[model samples]
Target: MSALSPSAQRVQAVLDGFGLGHRVVEHEGSTRTSEEAAASVGCDVAQIAKSLIFRGKDSGRPILVIASGVNRVDEKAVGRLIGEKIERADPEFVRASTGYAIGGVPPVGHAVPPLVLIDADLMALPMLWAAAGTPNAVFRLTPEELSRLTGGRIEAVRKG
Candidate 1:
C-alpha cells in the first residue's frame, strides 16, 4: 500500500472513526490558500471551508473556526460565543493542537477536541470542500454533513 501524508492519514482516521463515506482527491501541488485550493479542486472559492485555529482566552484550550472562503472570521463574535477572548493560533500552537501544519488543518481529528464553530455562509453552497488533513488533499460534502461529521456548531462565525 502507498503511504499517506500525515494530514491525509489523520483525516482518513477521523472519517473512519465516524463511519463517514468520503472520497479523497489529491492535487499535484500545494493548495495552501483558499484561491489556490479552489482552483486545484475545480470548485468555487466560496465553497472552500478554511479550518482556522485560535487560542482561547483561558490560554489553555484552542477553538477551531471553519469559515467559508469568501468570508472572514469575526474574532469578537467568536470570542463572545466562546465566552472568552480569542486570537489566531501561532504556527507552533496550531501544529501542537491539531497535529497538522497551518494550511493543512482538517475540520476533524485534532489531538484535542477544539470547540468547533462552522460558518453559516458555508450552508449556502450546495457542495463544500475542506482540507483532508493535507494541503493537497480535499473532500467534497454538504455543509450540514461536514458540520455533523466534525461535531461542529453551525453559527455566524464569519463576516463578509
Candidate 2:
C-alpha cells in the first residue's frame, strides 16, 4: 500500500543486479524476528532464513551467519571456521557494517560485505524467505540460490 522504504529499494537494486528482481514482496507490520516473519508469511519458522551478524574478535570485521529460523548459531563452530573468536554484533556495528538495523539486514547487499556462512539445515528446505531490507520486506529464493548470491559457505552452524 505504501511506498517501498529506502532499505528495500537498495535491496531491490542489488537483487536486480543479480538478476533476482522478481522476488521482492512488501508487507505490513514488522517482521523483525524470524518468528515474526514466519507468522507474517504463514509459514513454518524453519522456512525463514535469518541473517544474523557477528563480530569477529580476531579480524575486527563483521561476519554473517545466515541461519535457519528454527536454529541458533553455534559461535564456537563459526569461530573455528573463520580462525577467530566470535561475538554478537552490536546494533551500531550492525548498522554501520550492513547498512541495516539488526532486525532488517539481508543476506546480501551490505555496506561492508562480511564473510557469510549459511546454515546447512536451511538447505534442506526447498525454498526460503529472507529479509529484503526493511523489517516488513522479504524475498524468496532457493537455498542454493542464496549460497550463490552471497558466496557463502554452507556449514553446520546450528547449535548442537
lDDT of each: 0.86, 0.90
The global Cα lDDT (0 to 1) of model 2 is 0.90
Residue range 36-127, candidate 2, lDDT tens digits = 99988888899999999999996779999999999988999999988899998889999999999878899999999899999999999998
Tens digit per residue, CA lDDT, model 1, 86-139: 987899999899888888888888888899999999988899988887778888
Candidates in order: C-alpha RMSD to true structure? 1.6, 1.1
Candidate 2 Cα deviation (angstroms), residue 131: 0.6
- Which candidate number maximizes TM-score? 2
TM-score of 1: 0.93
